[model samples]
Target: MLYITGTPIGNLDDMSYRAVSTLAAVDEILCEDTRTTRKLTNHFEITTPLRSYHDFNKETATEEIIEELKAGKSFALVTDAGMPVISDPGFELVSRLQDESLDYTVIPAASAFTMALVASGIPSYEFTYFGFLPKSNQKRQEKLTEILHHRKTAVIYESPHRMKQLLKDLVKFDPKRLVSISREITKKFEQHERKTANELLHMMDKEIPLKGEFVVIIEGYEEETVNFTGTAKDHVSELVNEGMRPKDAIKLVSELRGMKKQHVYDEFHK
Candidate 1:
């Protein structure tokens, strides 16, 4: 059995008693960084042995861990912060464990994304977690476009250095769009700011300092009803005239009217 543990994101007090005990009791503690995990173990006096299990060595480490589990060894998997396997290593291990009929369970705790969502004041009925955007400009822009069109709230993880660029891109895509930025979660200087992309961009350095990891919550796109009293081709044509690509327009029309994409494509191009 493997214990998928959740560690404190910032505050050490957030570490649960169960997590500490499990870490101490486990045959081995698998962590992304032994040094980082050592601090936590030292704090709680958890003397269980620590092993390196991160992205670089996950493929090889996973198989070895599987064999140990088969031999009746129980391990606890943790990351530098937050829950293991969430935008972190351990996913492959968990998936492999499932495949091999090995047992595992999660020890829930604080999550920056969910905390940011509730604090954002945006409608949380439905939302999407887009962990981190691509580092490049073109790919990031394409992803930003997709997020801009998403009808539900979107959550994103970003670094301090790229915070400005993210806000800039958001302003370019939709200046008036509501966005919430949360940083230093569970720490002394934790801050949550809610404003439009343009407003936030203007106040970047002055008010919102670039520091700590950031969780960006963007308000969902509210699509307007398209009342086109015309043929399917005409509907597609009108969208195309408004600068939407023909292929994209066809897809939008199909989605709005609940028709198949190929059916709409045939009508529009016939």
Candidate 2:
């Protein structure tokens, strides 16, 4: 049997009893970083040996792990922090285990996103978890635009180094949008700041620390009821006549009409 366990995101005390016992019982533990996992194991006095299984060695490690599983060796998979397969490794191995008809169980524990979301005080009725934005500036902007248009709350992970840039992009896309920035969750110096995108940009260097992993929770776009009677093209043309650029006009009309920008652009251009 394979155990997919969740480790603490920051606070070591968050580790579950079942998770600790499972790790102790397993013949071997697969870890994203053996050195990191070793600290946890040492703290709990767990003697289970750990083997490296990260993105760099995933392909080769999966084959070897599967063979061991075939030979009736039980193993527990864990990431450096939080749940395995959640913005972390373990998906590929889980898929292979399923294909081979191997049994596996998840030992549930704290997840950073969930902690951040609940702490954010944002509407939790419905939300979309966007693990992390693309590294490229263009791709990141496109994703921010897409998130801006999302009707439900959105959650995203980002590193400290890029936090300021992300805040700037958010301000550029929609300055008034509400956001919650959380960092060092469950740690002694953990912090959460709720503010508008524009406010966050101003607070970036002055107030917010750029020192730890961050979770950004953005409030959803609230649609307004605009009583424009003209067709989409007519609305676009009117905006363009009112000094708005054609592309900007199309975007505004699309948002007002709850239609795709590309569709509005095509209609206006044609």
Candidate 2 C-alpha RMSD relative to the actual structure: 4.5
* Model 1 / residue 37 / CA error / Å: 1.0
lDDT of 2 by residue, 59-109 (tens): 999999999999999999999999999988889999999999989999998
TM-score of candidate 2 relative to the true fold: 0.86
lDDT by residue (51-106, candidate 1, tens digit) is 99998999999999999999999999999998888789988898899899999999
Q: Give the residue spans of candidate 1 off by over 4 A.
A: 225-253, 256-259, 263-270
Model 1 gets an lDDT of 0.88
lDDT of each: 0.88, 0.87
Tell me the TM-score of each prediction against the true structure.
Answer: 0.88, 0.86
